[model samples]
Target: MKIAIIDDNSFLISSIKEKLSFFEEIQVKYTANNGADLLEKLDKDHNLDALLMDIEMPVLNGIETTLAVKQKYPQIKIIMLTVFDNDENIFNAIKAGADGYLLKDVNPHELFNGIVDTLNGGAAMNPSIALKTLKLLRNPVDFKDVSKEEINLTNREVEVLEQLSKGLSYKVIADNLFLSPSTVRKHIENIYSKLQVHSKLEAVQKARRNNLI
Candidate 1:
């Protein structure tokens, strides 16, 4: 199986490479330092079977990268290999189309199995992560009541957010509002903070639930 590993830490990438070396059936195609780097590489050669993605990286995070990769290369499977097994990270990674989630401390054998399982069209996850995923599914977050108090958004911010909900690009939104792309991005950043959310999807969903847009 051809596999690619992505992580900011060179040592960690080396460690994962070393672990994967034990499996004769697996071939390490290449390693990337971050999501943007990985995307650039894939643009040149995207024939790999799967990817070992790190959740925390500069330029583009794992969750965001996973979403982009899945949209552009749906055939490739992605497994989040990270130290974080937190609820938010797990939830976002899954939502972003990760086929698996494994902690960085996972045993080599288990890691290999996860890759194999994912390639076989099965979802791979650590035991704890699976339990947490089950819990999250059982008790999903209610975005409407996420914050007890009202979330106050400026009229300009609201206009930007409404544009965002339409799936318009930042440049397009900027043009519509007669503002610079950087200004639109700033509005989005502020919107994320005020909504206590991260991604555009989350922000839009929360806003809709709260009738903010």
Candidate 2:
């Protein structure tokens, strides 16, 4: 079956390729370092049967990527292949329509089996993950519009974010807002914290996606 791999770590990508190399039935169609790159490639090649995606990436993350891919190509199975196994990550992944969830350190044989099972219309989740999924189903959490939930940015924070969206540097943003650079930096820190994003690009993307800006 045709497959694609997406991960920011080149070494991890190579390792996954090495593990899949043992299986003749699996063809590695392409590799991308991030979700945006993968989407561009998928647009060109949409022939892939499945995609092995990482959860943490620049530009776009695995959860967002999975959501986008499922919306565009529901037939293509997506399995999140990452090391993160926390409840939040697993829950978000399921909510994003992942066909399976496997750790990056999964054994080669099991990885191959999981891929085959997923393609054959079965959810391939690790035992722990499966248990979590069941528990989540038995007692569903109140998600309450997670993607667009109000982040409650302050007026100053909103101003800073608007300036940020214009691609202004911290100094320029400070100058425009008539605030000290240190204050601007503090506001950005608060913004990242409220947004639960790590980088500027992720913050901006999430802001735009949620219409916070």
Model 2 local distance difference test score: 0.92
Looking at model 2, residue 86 earns an lDDT score of: 60
lDDT of 2 at 182: 97
How many Å off is the CA of 204 in candidate 2? 18
Give one digit per residue, the lDDT tens place, for model 2 in 48-129: 9999999988899999999999999999999999877766678999889999999998999999999999999998888988
Model 2: CA > 4 A from native? 143-213
Shift in Å, residue 73, candidate 1: 0.4
- The stretch of ten residues in a row with the least summed lDDT in candidate 1 is 141-150
Q: lDDT value for candidate 1? A: 0.92
Instruction: For residues 1-213, write the lDDT of model 1, one tens digit per residue.
Output: 998999999999999998998999999999999999999999999999999999878788898999999999999999999987767788889999999999999999999999999999998899999999999999887533444558999999999999999999999999999999999999999999999887897788669757899
Model 2 weakest 10-residue run by lDDT: 141-150
* Residue pairs in clash, model 2: none
